[model samples]
Structures are given as C-alpha cells and as structure tokens.
Target: MARMLEISKLTIRNFFCLREFEISFQNRGLVLISGPNGSGKSSIYEAILWCLFNRTARQSRVDDVVNDIVKKDCQVIIDGYLNGKPLKVSRFRKHSVAGNDLVVVYDGENFKGSPSEIQLQLEKLVRADFNQFLLISSFIPERIRTFAAATPAQRLAILGGILDLHHFDMAYEYTRSRLKQYQVELASLEKEISVIERNLEGIKADIDYLERNKAKKKEEAEEEKHQLVLEKRRLIYRIKQVQKELERFQKGKAVDYEAEERKLKEERNELSSKLTQINGKLHSLRQQYHDLQQIEAKDYIGKPCPVCERPISKNLVHRLMQDHKRKMSVVSRQIKTAEEEKEEIENRINELQKRIEYLATEKLSQEKARIQYENELSNLRDKLSFVQNKIDSIEKDISTYDNLLKKRYKDLKKNRKEIDKLIEKQNELNHKIELYEIIKEMFGKKGIRFEYIRQVLQKLEEETQKILYVLSSSKLDLEIEVNNKEEIEIKVYRTGIKKRYEDCSSGEKHRIECALAFGLNRMARSFHLMSTNFLFLDELFDRALDVEGQEKVFEILQQMEREIETVFVVSHRPELQSQFSNVVVMRG
Candidate 1:
C-alpha cells in the first residue's frame, strides 16, 4: 500500500530567502503552488530536501547554504507522517559553536534515534533514499521532458540504478572473480604437485642408485678392509725400521722443534701489529672524510664553524671539500696497503702452520719409533699384540655402511608420502576448478540472468508506450527496439511516419516524458525497487506551451494525479489553479 504524506507544517528560518516562513499541507487533491520569481517557492522544495536528507540541491557546501544576508543560523522543518504514524522531522544548523552544524530529529512511532538511524528508518518507510526520491517521486523545475529526450543507452543506465539491475552485474563480477581465483589456485597447486612429483622421482632415482651400488659398496668395503690390513702391516714394518733409525737419535741430541715454532710465531705477531696500526689510521681518516661530507651536504646551514664562531668564505668551503677528497684518497691507499701487509702476514703464518704440522708429525713418528725401540728390546710380544688390536677397529667402520643405505631408503619413503598428499590436493583442486568453470558459464554476460534483464527492459518499454498512448492526444505509437547487448532506440510512428525521440516536437516530447515518468514509477513499485506516494512538478509547466499542448499536459497531469496519492505542481499560471482542487498562493 502506498503511504500518504501529510505536511501539517513546514518551517523555514533564515534559510535562503525564507526569513521566517511556515505553511500547512493538510488539504488534499491537486496541490497548486503559484508564486512569482524569487518568492521562495523553490526554497520550499530545498527545505524539504534538507529536512529529509540534511542536504539541499541548491549547493554542495552546507556551510554556505545559509543566507549570507541573515548571517545567522539556517533551519528547515517538515512535519509529516509515514503510514498513519505521527512523524516530525527537524533539520537545523546552529548559531552558536556549542551546537551542531546540522541536527536532524525524527519523531515517528516509538523510535527515537540519531540522524543516521532516522534516515535508515525513513528509507524503510519511504523505500527510497534522497537521490531516488528526486528521480521517482519529485518532478523538479526545468526538467519536464529531460528523461525521455535522453539517449537510449543513457536511459538504460538510469533505469538500471533505480531498478537495482546493477546487482546482477555485481553478482556476475563476483562469480567471475571466484572463477579466476580458483583457476589460479588450481594452477599453483599443479605447479607444487609437479615439484613434489619431481622430488619424488629424484628420491626414487637416488634409491635406485643406492640399491644398484649396495653390493658394489659391500665388495668395496671388503677390499678396503684388506687394504687397511696391508697398511697396518706396512706401518708395523716401518715402525721396526724407524726404531733402528731412532737408535741414532738415542745416541744424538734432542732438537727443540717447539722452540723453532715459537720464533716463527713471534715474527707473525709483530707483522700483525703493524697491519693493525695501519688499519686504525685508515679508519680514522675515513671517519674524518665522512664527517666532512656530512658537513658539505648541509653547507648552507651556517657560514662559519659553530666552534670557531668566525665567518668563513666560500673559498674556505671549497678548500674543505678538497681536503676531504684528498683525505678519502689517502685513506683508500692506506686501506689497500694495510690489506696487502695483512695478506703477507697471513701467508707467513700459513707457512709457519705447515712447518709446525710437519714438525709435529715427524716428532710423533720419531717418538713412537723411540718408544717401540725401547718396548721391542724389552718385550716383542706386547708390541705385536698392540698392532693386532689396531686391525680390529678398521673392520667396524666397514659394517656401518648398511645403516647409511637404510637412511637413504627412509628419505625416499618420506618423499613418496609427501607426493601422495600433494596429488590428493591436486585432484581436489581440479574438481573445484571444473565446478568453477560451470559457474562462470552460468554467470557470464549472456548467461542465466541476461534474458531476465531483457524481459524487464521489454516490460518497461511496453508500460511506457501504454502510458504514452493514454496521455498523448495524437495518433502516436511508441516502440523501443534494442540490440542483443541491450542498447535501446526509441522509434515513434506518428500517422505511419516514423521518427526518433530527438526528432519529436516539444509537445510530443513532453507527453513522452510524462509517460516515462509514470511508467518508471509504476515499474519501480511493481518491481518493489522503491516506494513513494508523492509526485512533484516544480515549475515544470512554466515553459512556453500552446493551448493544445497545455490541455494535453493538463490531461496527463490529471490522469497522473488520480494514480498517485499526492501531486504538487509549482507554477506561475494562476488560471490553472482553478483546475486543481487545492491552491497555494505565495507573495514576496
């Protein structure tokens, strides 16, 4: 059911040209607002918009919307009802800093809330927002036949928004996005699956290689054990030979290898000290260069040094930059020299390390030979038993290679397990991708909902043409044709002569606008897009109209007035007021 709007009072204070104005809209049937220019009739609509939306169509800047001549607070109030409920809306901007810039109070039924909450409740009641109200409910000044004269594509766009057809577009886009996301996920999974498969293959190859070489490794371990026995025997023989050679050492002096190593170490330490001193000097020079660069970067900050407290010339700045450059160059050279010296010292240390290792090896061998010489001379049986113990240790190492091979098998088993999991996930993603493809097909532009949109467009055209036939006095037939993509073109046949909407006369165009407005409003209600009980014409009939055109418009208005709950017409023609059941007169 369409809710009736009854304005018991409208108050405007210091807003636009309305210093302090109030009006009552309690009467019914054909409300006529007749006023001259600058009489603030239009401001009434502005006040309504403000009181409803906390905004006005007069300007975008709310702060400047107040009357400059008044230099005070601006306010407008529209007290009315929605569906038999008592509703009073008060919209005001304050005169003091303590108050708000815009205040909205909506008292309807049992709900009392803030402006935003009130607006939501209002949209629930009226079934439209501020912009939707202007499009479907209000017929404002200077836009009588505008919608019908617009291009067909442009018409579709406007109708689409009010009809909420963009929701279909949004749904289709959402489906497509999901489709892309699934496809990408599936592709990523496939790549990951491939990587796992490749890793699995590598593991299998390694296992196969290990299996193939297992026997070979066992054979090699046997051979290595035999070679180790030979090495042990050779060592035993060499020990006997070295014992005989060390008999000379027993008769000779003991050379101090440790003392010789210490002498080489002292030389390395002195060279390292020189290198450290050179590096330290280089570091200090580099730091000074960096400080100079930092100072030069902000050379404009001061003319002289803060420590010296003396004015310095530009020449001095240049000299300082040159000195910094020279210092950097010197530091670079010093770094190179220090690095070279360190490298030379490191090389000497490495030479000493090799010599020390060789000396230690020789000393160990000679000491062992000396010990063997003493032991064999004392007891040969104990020395032979020690060599036999050494041979048992080598055999234990050969047996451990089997454990290493088992570890390789364990790794292969782990890789295969991971591969199996990846394949399972891949299969699941593949099925999901298939389902997404079907979903994409269903939501594509030419898919399931496309025909529904076409049907709605067809209904709109039919309703518009039906209204046009009823409103227009001429023998006019309207047809709207569109391509598959929903591009529309309006073709009018007047006495079998065809013409576009742009080619129509002003009277014919006005009739088309009236038809479209009524049809669109009907469609809006039929589709439950938005709901409104009022239609307004703000200076819509003020344009130049001949007698016949005026009569046709009056007929259309009368027909529309009966269909709608309330129709407010703002005009300058007072004679037309007699045609209306209710009249409002405004005086400047």
Candidate 2:
C-alpha cells in the first residue's frame, strides 16, 4: 500500500524541443496533456531527464543538444515533491559556458543541502541515473533494437553495465584469451610437425641413396678383389715360367766354349810364328821393296829379278813371287774366317745371358705389381667396410629421426586436443556470459541474482499477459513464461492452442505493447506510492488499441488511481478525452 507522488510545477525556457513552456501537476485523478506530434508531448519527458541527469534522451553531444534547445542565455527549472516535501532543481547555460555548460540547483527543506547534495540524495532514492528513469520513446525502441542487433561482446558489455556483472565479463574474457593462446600454440605445433615430417622424408631419401650406392660400391669392390686375386695367380704362374726359362738358360751349353778354346790356342801359336817370320821377311822385303821402289817402271821389272837371282828376267821373278804371295793370302783368309766365327759365337753367348737376366728381372717386376694390386684391393675392401658401417650408422640415425618425428606429431596431436578442449570450455563460458548479460539487461543491479530476477521477470510477464487478456476482452489468453535463459516468451492462447508473438497481428502487437506499458506503470505506481501519492503518464494509450482495450486501460487506471492518491494520463486519444479530470491542449 503506497501513495502517489506529485509534481507541483515545471517551467522550461529554451529547453530541448520545448522552447518556452510551463506546466503544473495536481494530486488528484487523470490530467491529460493533449497535443500533436511536435507539440512537445515527449519534450516534457526529455526535459525531466535533462533537469535531473544533465543529459538528454537522444544521447547527443551536450553542446549540440544544449544549443538546439537553450538560447545563449536561458535556464530550465523543475519543481516537484516526494510525499508533501518541497523539491526544486534548475539548469541554465551562460554565454561563457563552453561544454555541458549547465548548472543544477536543489532546495529541499527536509534535507537542507546544496544542489550537488540534492542530486546525490535523488540518485540514492531512484537507485538509477535520472535519465534512465524516464525511459523515453526513442530510448525504449533503441534499447530493444540494440539488444537484438548487438554482437555478443557488446551485449555482454551492456548487460554487465546494467547488472553490475563486470567481474563475470572479465573472467569470461580472460578465459577466452587463454583459449586463443592455446589455439595459436597448437597451430605452431602443427607447423613444427610438418617441418619435422619433411626432414624425415629427406632423411629417408638420403638413406635410400646410401643403401643403393653402398650395395653397388660393395659389389664393385668385391669384383676388384676377385680380379686382383686372379691377376696375382697369373703373376705367380708367369714368375714360375720365367724362373724355369732362366734355369734352362743357366744349365744349357755355353755357345763356342770348345771352339773359343781352340781358337785361342791356335791364334796364340800363329801370332808367335807370324811375328818371327814377319820379322825376317819384313827386313828382306824392305830391302827388296826399297830396291823396287828406287827403280822406274822399266827398272821395276828387272828389280824383281834382283830379289830372285835364279831368274834374270823381271817377268819370271814376278810370276814366281806372286805364286808364293797368293798361297800366303789364302792362308790368311782362312785364319780371318776362323777368327770371325769365334767372335760370332762369343757374341751369341753374351746375348743369351742378357736375355735370361731380363726375363728374371721382368718376372720379379710382375710379382711386385701383383703384390701392389693385392695391397690396393685390401685397402679398398677396408674402405668399403668403413663406408658400409657409416651408412648403417646413418640409417640408424635416420630411424631415430623418424621416431622423433612420430613423437613430435603425437605431441602436436595432444596439444591440438588440449586446444579443442579449451575451446569447448571457452564456448561454455561464452554461453554463460551470454546468460549473465540477458539476466542483467532484463533486471537491474538489485535483480543481479539470476534465479530471483528470473522469478520477478516471470511474475511481471504473467501480470502483463493477464492485463493484455483483460484489455483484449479475453479473446486472447496471453500466456507468459520465463525460458531457460531467463528470456521472456509471450504466447496468445486462441482456440485452445498457444500462438507465439510472431503469430499475432499488428493490432495484437500494439495491444501487447500497451499491456506491457500498463503493467510497468502499475509496478512503478506501487513502488512510488510507498513515499508519494501521485503518478503521471504521458501518452500511455498511443497504441492502436480498440475501444474495448481503451476502456479496459481506463478502468484499470481509475481503479489504480483510487488505490493511490492520484493518477495523471496524458494523451491525445479521442476516446480518453472525456475520461480525464483535466485536459490541456497545446498548439504550435
């Protein structure tokens, strides 16, 4: 059981769309302020918001808003009461004022405080900013639209502001950031896995190449070793052949051994005899030859005869000596032939010895070549073994790399799984965040507790639906419910079947809006009546409600007014023109 609050008077001078106006309130029944669209019906609400909160309904810049309404020098004054107490607040703009250049004043006898002090007191009473209390036409529509259109983050912010759930929003954001970090980490791990896999592929290629080349080199080395063995055996056989030939040469008869002996003895004897005989013959031939040399050709003929005294004729002596000389020349020719034969035999024997030596030396050279070849083969085999061992080690290393790569991939998969889980958790947190926002927006800070606010909203919705049904003559049984997430769902029960808001017609939608407004008005009236006894509604019946709906609203307002101290309905509706106690008509 509460009373109604009254506004004693309100004066405006160049304030918003209200150029110059003044209005007064009565603590009685309905008082309608009737006007056209631009006749400042809504300006009164904007002025109230500005006077109390130093802001406007449009959320425009303070300078632009002030300039649009107030002149260079003007002021706005609002006077009201809370349960028979004097309340006063004034705002003005001066020529020297630059930005938001408005002043506020408050004079209350109960709390003899300054304007700032009065503002603080009012804020405490309203439990919200003054601008927020006046839910203007544009404000309501904009809020509904924003709620429907904003992104999740924006929605969360708005909800946090409304519900004072900043902590929840912050926690949700932190969790989301952590989830993003984990996702990035997972991506990096995947990239590393790809790089490792590529490296493993390259290593495999190298291993394959090594295996092929190693096999080929091993085969070639073995073949060379076999060839070396065969060459060594052939060298051994050749050495044996040379050795046998050398032995035969060493054991065979020496050419000209006996003939050389005989030639030596005969030559020695002949040399001695020839020396003696030539010595005597040389003396005789010198004397005779000198005598023949001293003679002329004609004398030489007779000189030969002098050597042979038995023949006085030259021809006769010459012929006898020529015969003896011819016999000696024959003997000398035979001796020279024999000496040449002995020399030829000696030369042949020397040549055979040299040939034997050369064959033996060549055999030794072949053996040395075979030994070198064997050593080379042995060295090559050792190198090939070493290379094979290296290849094996490389293969083992490649295997280890493969295992390591597998491990890395496994770890990457594990990281990805962790990221996925974190993302899932993040999504859950996001849902919770959305839930918190919806709760806050529907209910204020006082209704921050989800379950309690949900119950209250449910009750409000139910009362609204009942009011709608009454207004609609029960042709529609409006059903209201609070969904799982605390959202309001309204259904029209027609023909024993429930139809959602979407299934309703335009007129029905208008009725729903009117019903909701009346329900809120009733709630506000009850709350305000606790300390006051007056309620004022401006343009409450602008919806396309029928005559029956209007009558139902009027009846409700009348009943509520009696319960409270007073009620004021401001509207231009012809149906409600005669229903109010007082009427004020404004024209541009």
Candidate 3:
C-alpha cells in the first residue's frame, strides 16, 4: 500500500558545509543526486533525515550534529507525503557558548506541551525515540558490504531490522531462556534419578544380605531338626533295650527255685519214716530182755530137776539149759541192734528237718526275689513306654520344624528372584535416562533443532532460487541448500550440470547477492500482504557488472516495471542515467 514516497521540499541551514540548500524528490520515478566529493550532495541527505527524525545517519551526538556550515541560529525543514498523507517535520539547533540547544516540531504542532503528552504520542507512533531514526547518507552497496563484514550477531540485527522480524528475534530470545530453564529442570531430574538409583542399589544389597541371613537361619534350623531326630532315635533304642530286659526279668527262667524246693522236702519225709520203724523194733527187744530177767535162771534150773521128775538124765538136762541160754543171747543181740538203728534214724531225722528248714528259708528268699524283680520290671516297662512316647512327640515336632523351614526357604528364594527382576528393571531405566540426556545435550548445543528450523530454511532456499533465476536471465540456474550442519550453501548448474557456489565468479557472487535481496523483498511482501506496485533498486549494479551484465540488469528491471506500477533506480553510472526517462543533476 505504500507505493510512493515523495519529498516535496527540503531546506538545510548550517549543516555539514551546506549553509543553505533546497531539494525536491520526484513522486513516481528515480531521482539522481550526484556531485564530486564535498559538493554538499551528502549534506542534503543529512538535512532530510535531520528534519524528519532529528538525528544523523552516523549516530552522532546532538551537539556534534549541529552542522558546522550553519550560523549560530539555524534550522532544517522536511515536507513529504507518506502513503499520500501530508507530513511536515522541522528541527532548530541554536548555538550557545555553553552548548547547542535543539527544538522539534511535528505536523505544524510544537513540542512545547507537557512532556508526558509528547512521550505518549511518540511511543505510540514509532516505539522508539524520533532522534534515533535519522540517516545522513544512503546505505548503498558499500554499507551493505560493511554490514556483511561485521559479526554474525550484528548482521542478524541488521537483517532483522530490514525484514521487520524484531518480534521473531525477541521470541527466539525468550525461547532460549525457556530452554535454559528446561535444562536446569532436566538436571534436577537427573540428579533425583541418580539418587533414587543409588538408593535402589543399596536396597538391593540389603535384600541380598537379608536373604543370606535367612538362608543361614534356615540351615541352622535344619541342623537342629536333624539333631532332634537323632536324639529321638537314640531314645527309642534305649527304650527298646530296657523293654527287652524287663521282659526277661518277668519270665524268671534264670533261677530253678521251685524244683530245688520240691527235692529238699521229699528227702526230709523219707528220713522221718525210717526213724519211726527203728523206734518200734527197739521197744520189742527191750521187753524180751525184761522177761528173761524175770525167769531167774539159776533158781529155775535147780527147781526144774525137782519139778520135772521124768527121764532126768544129766545130758538131757544140760541140752535143755543150753537151748534156753542160746535163746537169751539171740534176744539180747536183737535188742542192741534195734537200739543202734533207732539212734541213727533219730540223727538222720534231725538232719533232714534241718535241711527242710533251710530249704523253706531258701524258697521264701526266692519268692521275695521274684516279687522284687517283678516290681522292678513293671517300673522299667512304664519308663520305657514314657521314653518311647517322648521320642514320638519329638519326632512329630521335628517333622513340623522341617516343614516350616522348607516353607521359609521357598519364600526367601522367591523374594530373591523378585529383587533380581527389580535390579534388571532399574538398570534398563537408567540406560534410557542416559540416552535422553545425550540427545538433550546435542539439541542444546545447536541454536535450534532440525524440526524447528527446517521449514524456515526450506522457504528461504525456494525464494532464493526464484530470484537467482530472474537475475541470471535464464542462462544459469542456481539452487540454494542448507546442509545438515545448518550452513547455507549454493549450487549452480549450467547445461543441466550442477556446480558449487564457491566455483562461481565475482559476477556470480554479485548476482547471488541481488537474487538473495530480491528473495528477501518477496518474502516481506508475502508476509506483510503488500501490493507489489513498485520496486526500489539502489546502487546494486555498480561494482561487478560489465556492459553486457548491465544490459541484463536493465532488462530485468524493465521486465519488473512492465509487470508492476513503477521501478525506481538510483545510480551514478552513465549507462543507468541514460536508461531513465527523466534526470535531474545537482551541481556545487
């Protein structure tokens, strides 16, 4: 929409060797202002900026900017139309012994009102002080070259200002600040993860130790169970042994006590019968001897001769007496034998009685011994039974202990397995975290990531290629590409063969710069929704062009003018001056 900018009038007083000067600009075409060095041609440009914005292009101070050619009281005026609207701006610089004083006026309105009102209106219109926008000279090819030679940050600033992308620059700075904050947060997260992982490792170690301790306890419990079983077995064996001894004692087969008592009683009874028979025989023999003593043998023999009186021969009487004497002797011997037999029988009976008494005493003792053995055997059997029961109970307790130990061991093994799985998972998470850190660091070192900058670079390249085609007169084709490292490189082609940008000539570089500028202009128009009614070309075709190159440049400019409303060119070259429809010359 800003199709025409015309300077209707400009007046300079005491400014840069131009004590008084006047200039006017054409509305729709190129206007050339040219002279030799120090011809006040540059001073005209300075006065135009000083009247509009009240500052110099060289960034000079206020006192120094007061022109040396002006008298003590001097002023400059600039009247123009921006977008067909009237604009009038003026500045006055008064010289004093102490310093120079400055005053400003805008659109016939004086800045003598409240300072608050002036600041508010100025901030609303420009967003910067009016003194900072002034220029004393045209920033042509030399200035562009100077800007290109500066650092990348300075170049970027200039490019940003030209493209009206200061907002984008500010946004980029904000993004960088946020990226730093993210990096700090990521560092904190990494530290926290490290601490957690360390603690996990420590917990794993503790689990391992606890598992080992559990295993030891289980082993000890198993040993105790085994010992208990062994003790129970020993108790069973002792009980069995005692039981066998008790059974043997109950049988009573080791002593033949009843048979010995029967034999002693039979011998005593036989001795008593023999003693009674001997006593009876001795009584009969004693009675026979007493009858013989009553017979009175001597007196009876003499009376037998007187009483008998029959056949009394001396031989017969003597034979009868002899018979009687034989009888008496027999009876006496019988009596003696009977008495001795009876005496022997009495002594045998006494001995047999003593033996019977001794046998009875021994039988009583054997009975008492049997009773004591039976009682002891009963007690032993009871003790053996009790021991056996204790062994059984111990065996059951040992079995229960074994079961518990096995269960505990199984649980411990399970816990150990789970711990191993956790350790493996923790290691995997740690590796993932490390990979993320590496990627984050790589992204941080570059200005921006591929995803964010790729589209912008692609658009730049396409636009640059289109401009290159226009500048090259369709004879040479060029393509601009950005490599993975984010460096911009150009590729050229002739006859459908590609060539590197560095391999091109100086003329090629000039062409490339023009194409790139045009590309930027096109981008601005597209972004701002501007009507392409005019194209402004400064001294871009001055340095690296021959006659043929200039002709080509003129051809392109002519083609653009035909398609658009107007084309303006400012140049000192005679060829360019002759190409224009109108010309105005300045002389000093």
RMSD of each: 37.1, 16.0, 22.2
Off by over 4 Å in 1: 1-10, 22-29, 58-64, 78-89, 94-100, 104-130, 141-144, 164-180, 215-453, 540-563
- The digit string of per-residue lDDT tens for model 3 on 1-588 reads 322334567777667666767755534444445444565555566665565455665566665656564545556766665445555555566734323333344455555544345545533433333321211113345444443244534544454454344454555556555555655665665566566556656656665665666566556656765666676566556656655664664565334445655665676567667766766767777777777666543444435456656545656657766776787899888887877777777777677677767767876765676676566656655665665566566565656555655655565565556556655655655565565455554454253444333444466567767666666766677654445554444566865788755566778767766666555555444433223233445566667876667776666666555544444455555555556675544454
Ranking by lDDT: 1, 3, 2
lDDT on C-alpha atoms for all candidate structures:
0.68, 0.55, 0.56
- Which stretches in model 3 have alpha-carbon errors above 4 Å? 1-8, 17-19, 40-68, 71-75, 82-85, 94-139, 146-158, 164-166, 172-467, 478-503, 522-538, 559-568, 574-576
Candidate 2 lDDT (Cα, whole model)? 0.55
Clash counts per candidate, in order, are 0, 9, 2
Error of 3 at 224 (Å): 60
Error of 3 at 71 (Å): 5.8
lDDT of 2 by residue, 1-588 (tens): 432234567787665556678876555556677777777666675676666676766675554434364445445676776545556766665444532333332343344465567667666654554422542112243343353244534643443344335544455455455556655665565566566556656655665665666666566656665665565565556555555554443454233343444555565555555555555555554555455444343433544345545434666546655665665566555545555555555555455555545555664665565566556555655655665565565555555656655665566566566656655665665566556555444343334445543554455566676777777777766554444554444556765677766667766666666666555444433333233344546655756666676778877677666765545565656555676667776663
Mind sharing the TM-score for model 2? 0.44
Question: Please, what are the lDDT tens digits per residue for candidate 1 over residues 269-336?
Answer: 77667767766765775676566556562473356677687876677777877776787777677667
Name the best candidate (by TM-score). 1
Q: TM-score for all predictions? A: 0.59, 0.44, 0.42
| Candidate 2: clashing pairs of residues | 2-529, 3-529, 3-532, 3-533, 4-532, 4-533, 4-534, 5-533, 5-534
lDDT of 1 at 210: 65
Ten-residue region with minimum lDDT total, candidate 1: 98-107
Q: Identify the superior model by TM-score, candidate 1 or candidate 2.
A: 1
